[model samples]
Target: SGAAPRVDPRLLAEGIEASRRAAGAQASRLSPTAAPRQVPNEPVHQDGLRGLVERYWDNPLQLERVLIGQVQPGPLSPTEQAQLGRLLVEKHLSADRGRTLSRIGDEQRNYPNLARALGRSFQAGALTDGHLGYLLGPQGLGTSSRRGFEYTGIATLVAASGSPALQSTTATRSWELGAKQTERHAAVDFHTAAMRATGGSTEATQVLLQQAGPALIAAVDAVADLSRRAPVHPYTNRFSTALGTLLTGLSHLPSSQATNPVGARIVGHLSEQHLTAPALRKGFFDYLRSARTSRSWRGLGPASGNAFTQQELLTRFKDPAIRNHIVTEQYYRMSQALEELLPGQASWATFAVWASRQAGSAIRGEPLAGASGTNANGVRAISHGNTLGASEIAPLFGAFAQTLRSNPDASFQEVWRAAGAPNKPLLREAFQNYFEAYQLRRSGGGADAIAERVLVANTLVAQHEQTALQADIDSAMRVQGVSMWSLELDIPGRVLDLNEDLTGQFPPELRYLRNPRARQLEQQFGGWGDSRMESLFNLFRLNQRDAALHGDWVV
Candidate 1:
């Protein structure tokens, strides 16, 4: 400390000049009509104060630098600092402030001082919901892994600064927008990119799982924390839906060595916080109860010509096919969670009973026979005309029962595998059964006529499944003798061949059968499933299971 570090006069001069240049540029942008001004060596004047406030309003970064003496050695006088802070707070309170505050908060470089000003403004009731909302918007939090943490800090700061009303409003809007961005769009992009990188290879997929696991966990944690802070917020439902979507996407990833640890972490976190909690079950059932009476749910998709009353629509929600799809998706997530958390400790019998109870409760209100109305196209029809019989979902239950009977101590994974791992096939079969039953019931036939109709429908479904399976088998057999490299190269052609074999199997006449049941089935499940990705994943799993069962190799 001989001479205490001497300041370089030249460096100090350069720094002041740079600050002047930066301030000038910001001033010009903020107030284009104002004449250009220069920083003076003397005490600040009114014009300088006005220009400084303008710059602060538009660009918080420069203001922060100046305030911290990064641009100049000396701080502003107390009076000038107060004036600048007051003006900035006034801007924050204004309705027309736009997203400038949010941008500054997200920059994070100047968060402490900005948060202080925001806090003061909130204390004075000068900060509006608009300001708080902008600060907590999707743009503020962003979709980057780093931004997720930044969002937590910003949200906490804002929540602490204001009344619950403002805090709740801001949190709701933030969640509404952020949920879609992070859970839907961003998650989809991550999955698509990972899939492309992995090229469907188990090893590559495992690497991706390890890399992305932390970020995924962080995102879910942030959502849970936010939801806890504002439990009554409307966006809470959005958060729940987002969680379900996240689980679905993660479950679709192929199981691998790397995925085991990652999956365990996720499963553990969810079980601790939500999945295994009674609160979650209560919340979900509550939602279903509310949704049953909701106009939106009643009016789902296109309006049918049958023009159902609200009550009729509510009754139709009890349709077995619809219930099966909903229950199966829930069961899928629960099964995956149990597999990772407890492994073989959980029995298939318990899950089967739980699933059955949930499905029954979800569709408990009405019998399918009660629904009589016209079609969406205005033609005469039954209101629940296309509803499946209670027995329609019996095959799926039978599959589970058989699995449990054969292996009483089977884990969720074993039972799932034994039952064909269901997924898209479960929904497809549910739809098939519903359509067949509907057609048979509507055919003006007694028991004998219905029996014959059932036989014909079963034959058709069996034929379609066999044909699809055989086509895949034939393609694999054709390339069995080829080298691995050649086989990889030949897969596209084989896929095309399989498609050709499946073409025209459901001819126009059969698909357009006068029965509404046939038309609805063709329209909904005609392509097998809603998503190509789901269909592909299900097919891969089915092939793997088949090979394991038969002690044979998969192509």
Candidate 2:
């Protein structure tokens, strides 16, 4: 009898989300237009849940009535799910996970209806991680029992050795535009099942992950290639988000739960083949970093879930390999961007130019904001091109360059970690702190206060603190160019997108300054920094400054 995981899988099952009807259930459901039924006198808060658990200590049957009945009818926020999990743990509600083995036995011996429905749901991609995790646990998808063999449809769908598997003849016709959609759904189902079952039972998810690895890798290559080759595919919009989820799930799987072979096949293959490539990596990461996508806190997954949260799915770059790749790819793009400006065929000059651009951008916002190769003599506020300016981009990326230069031999991952995991240095903040420290230099000054908050910097972010500081300073340094400072500093490489449009495929909001509306509006307001801009600028600056000076600013 295996002990349960730190978080109860039952809570994950029922508590994950309440509004979503479990897909593929044999039980009849209300019509789509029907109003949801609420459980009478259902627990509405944490205290209410705790009291119910305590009162029903020995009465699991009665206790589950409301939990299932209530959740089956409505939705639970991630907060509620977390609270339920904590209560279960605190109240010692967990039992031997093997306790589910008997249910599998009962189902296989007497009634296979429920079993078949769950199996069909899994095969059809109707279940997600939380649903599958719960099914593999207390809901009884089987532990190590022979009854588990009946769920081979789920495994077979994963092997994708059958039709509609994307590589197969039936799934490849040009008219069958939904081919990519089918493959992605199935892959999501199997990968999620592997993560869930691994958390619950060793034998099940291991077999799942091990079996799914080769097919998944193949599918990854195929779908990514097909999406690129035929961007007009009906499901083209979902390719990046779906692919991101797969890589993220694999990365989040701890080696302790998954076999080393599984990790090597999936993680290693993904990192080398997909992530190492520029366009593929960009598309995947764009999905992760994107805020304007269809994925949101309400429904969670890019592929609608049976029951889950965005926090639960985390298709957003959960893998460290991806993170490491992002660092490597950043420099790679930087090198490429710097190449056109490099002197004709100098062996070592590219790196030097890249370094200089880093310096030039950091100190004075350089190359004067032009397209990929042109260097004009004007404002360097991150134009649509090769120049690396700090004006429009965040200051944190500059810090990554600063960190990388100081530690020449460190791995990108190590360098980012040392610089601070998820933060880019706020240059103006750094400048202000450095100056403040200089004032107190005799006393060996300390910026004890603003040292640990990433939120404050985003405040520099939305407030356009760095933008204003750069524009004001660069307004003067256009002639002589401001000299670089903070040469030895390092910040989070994950902070900014290097102000480069890594993928030309993202939504307009993600495109930011590169969009047409901004330009048109600016033009209408009287060209650069005209009537329409001052009021907005003054609004952010004055309000933000007021909040900052009064110590009322917060994330």
Candidate 3:
């Protein structure tokens, strides 16, 4: 007879029985919201693995991402989810991709089905081989024993058709021999047929390349369009602004407020707060280069501030003190004014007044004093109010000024609305034109000729910039090994759209100046500079000098 069971074994058995009894009595019923919990009919405890395999096979497209090394297999832990999101953003968006991925991960936590939600990220190339290796270690399997069948299916097919599975004298050996014999005969026949085909390998390759040129370029152009320019994100914006402030502050003596120790401390504090100042300033200057053409800034996008949307503003500027002291406060106020106008009520004039006042304050009590002279009322400043024959409006405002002059019939309110108010250039131009007749009186020259010459110069500058941009885009694509034809078919409209978006803040007059009509006009007449009126020319000279001086006067 078998030896009697130990007392410990008996006691363990009893405890296990008791625990099962207790668990059965206390187990809660499944809630209605829970997923269907049908146990598999098969006794195999490999989990829903079988069903997943069948489903994946039925939907081959679902396996595309997995095959391409995107969307690592298995349920993602929170960390894995974050990793996948980052890969998606980096591969897709050219902007501050890491930040975008973080945002996506944060947002998707609320999704009911984490697996399905995570799966969507795979639509784009989400997974990289490095990510998979890191996740799975030396063995490709994850925490769960279940492996992706996509690999298994391919392996099964490759192995079944090619192997030494049989030995001599066996029935299987006879069939293997037969199969080998048939394959050998087929190979000989195929080689003989190939010898009679076309010219040689080189000729065939040339033919294939020629045939593929268009499609290749279109495809490349599409990718090129997508990869055109990385966005200058908020960090870049802050960096640019800080650099600009530093440069501006350094160029001119510190304001009276900035001269004291406390003021110096405040300057340091401001620098700390505006992290994207350097990038933001660069973006601003880049916009000048970008907008020098006739491309709409809509495609270029807003630099630092959100356009018409108060969400970013509200999120960042909840504190009244911070909002009031920072220049972004001015931006927030201007944005708020636009929000007010969006409901169909016209606040263009109101915004014009607001923007002009801000510009005035920027130049107030400084060298810009004479440039701020008002008409009969303090509300409206003289349009051509250049001090000592110099225009105080920033170089950026030149385009807007031209716009207003070109379209004299347009109201200050109308032009303001069109120009996207709180937009300095638009306001500057509107104000300049509001007092344009005054500028004509001051300049002692024919208004029409000056306006014509200025318009022409503005048009040419815009055209050249646009042409340069298109050429640069083409060159970049070629450098990336992408062909132009491939890009055209795959992403024809994408380049123009993106370029326009990158320069969205630009005034319309400056955008789209490279269109065929613009070129034709330039050829028919003189270059852009010839259209400038005597007063406008004088103002241009003053602005040019000031810019040079501004550049040279830095401490």
Candidate No. with top TM-score = 2
TM-score of 2: 0.26
Q: Per-residue CA lDDT of candidate 3, range 41-121, in tens?
A: 222321222222223322234333322323223232233233333343233232321222223222322322322323333
Candidate 2 lDDT (Cα, 0 to 1): 0.31
Per-residue error for 206 in candidate 2, Å, reads: 10
99 Cα displacement, candidate 1 (Å): 9.4
TM-score of each: 0.24, 0.26, 0.19
Q: Give the residue spans of candidate 2 off by over 4 A.
A: 1-219, 234-287, 290-555
Which 10 consecutive residues of model 1 have the lowest summed lDDT? 483-492
Model 1 lDDT at residue 172 = 44
Which candidate number has the best lDDT? 1
Residue-level lDDT of model 1, residues 485-517, one tens digit each, is 111211212221111112323222232345444
By TM-score rank, best first, the candidates go 2, 1, 3
Q: For residue 213, give model 2's deviation from the true position in Å.
A: 4.6
Which scores better on lDDT, 1 or 2? 1
